[model samples]
Target: MSEKQQRLVLSIIEFLNQSIADGTVKQDDREGLEVAVQCIGEAFGVDPNDESQVGRLSIKPASLSSLFDLFMKTRERMSGSTPSTSTPSPAASSSKVDKEAAEKEKEKGNKFVSAKKYNEAIEAYGRAIALNPSNAVYYSNRAAAHSFNNDHPSAIIDAQKALEVDSKFVKAYNRLGCVFDRIQVESLSNLSWRI
Candidate 1:
């Protein structure tokens, strides 16, 4: 991993560690936070299991600021605070039409889906949505990816958003149905096992 990327990972880990130490994070949530840190470490080619190595990792000031922003956003999300979307970001507010760029991202997402990289596909579809939020296809594509990732809630949200954007979006309905069906099957299986 590049130095900057390494720094970013470390900074996120540090934030999580601080949250836990300060009792801001509940005991039940600590495991998930630890797993998230491990995933970040793995993504950046670091072994989070090695406490010595994790301690040696250095974080730059710029990376710290970015990490702080990310932490704040995450805190807000955890608190169920809705982000203001009345004003779009600079990239989204630009006058230039980037339909081609959005299409390119969609294609990239498709390629990732074909490769069975659902997480990467979700990211690509997110970029497509950012570039062109009006496209219902992007949301539907992301919904499919989220389903593949076993993130049923996110899949449902994306599918619903797609339908809101275009009520006639057949794929969104299909994906939403599939996700609900899977959840039902899983629930039934669990109940049967308990019985």
Candidate 2:
């Protein structure tokens, strides 16, 4: 990594360390944050404990929070200077294309479901969901694929994600209910077998 990037990583490590010490991070997550600091330090080939590494950022941004705030302000300034236009910005155009692509991927997933290829269906729906995470139907479709694959845990998670995306989506609620029913039935079946 470049020195600039390393400096930034060092600043992030410093921030994480400070959070751990200041009790901003939960006690349970402190160890994981420490591990993350170690990994970031190793990845950047910089030692967080070494004062010099942490001091480099002091020239401009004393900490990661300040650096981020500076970045956001700069972004706001840049955005304000852009002229209003009828044509869409590149990012907005890209989002439109992504929505179309997500729909296509969802169609592919539906075809896979009809063919009883649960894994392929799951992968297709995953791509769709990744592209357009706001779409509850993609998540619900993935949940169905997971259910067909007998992956109850994944089905439950996807259903929950679907609900998160659109709370009023009845399909997600049904999918969640169905997964719970299936789990109950499986538990009963296993108990009966044991008996």
Candidate 3:
């Protein structure tokens, strides 16, 4: 690994240590270190051009243990399998292609959001939502972009829609709470200053 890659790994390791200190990572997980590593690989976006940084962007375990267990088990299962080893049928190939295209559209949306191009981001996310309507993340992401543009009403509507689709989405809940908090604080300040 390059020096940059080494530094990234060290930074993530430090984060892991802090999480452990804060009781984010349980002691039992230490026994399944390999599974954890694989889980990291499955979640992280490995660069196509730089496979060495496969687990560069590490994610943490959610509050739910069962879901984390499931993710780790799935990653373990996939670790033994090679991408080129599978002989996917024609229907499977077509389905995979469709999924990839949808993911590509989502990437474009994310790029626009990162660029602070809120309106264009919303449009890109809209296209992604059309391609994968069932995905709650698409709606939630667009809602965030809408919020960034100061379209709080539209953001609230989209966030509500996302929550309707996936009630378990904590991100949607957090965003909604933040929006409500902003409104509440503004109204409270106005009322207090009016007197």
CA-lDDT, candidates in order: 0.72, 0.73, 0.59
Q: Compared with the true structure, what per-residue lDDT tens digits does model 1 show for residues 77-135?
A: 44555445312223334234677888999999999999999999999999989888878
- Steric clash pairs (candidate 3): none
Ranking by lDDT: 2, 1, 3
Model 1 stretches astray by more than 4 angstroms? 1-97, 191-195
**Candidate 3 segments exceeding 4 Å error:** 1-95, 185-195
Best candidate, TM-score-wise?
Answer: 2
Report the poorest 10 consecutive residues by lDDT, candidate 2.
83-92
Give the CA lDDT, 0 to 100, for residue 180 in model 2: 58
Q: What are the candidates' C-alpha RMSDs? A: 14.9, 17.3, 17.1
What TM value does model 3 have? 0.46
Q: What value of lDDT does candidate 2 attain over all alpha carbons?
A: 0.73
How many clashing pairs does model 3 include?
Answer: 0
Which ranking of candidates, highest TM-score first?
A: 2, 1, 3
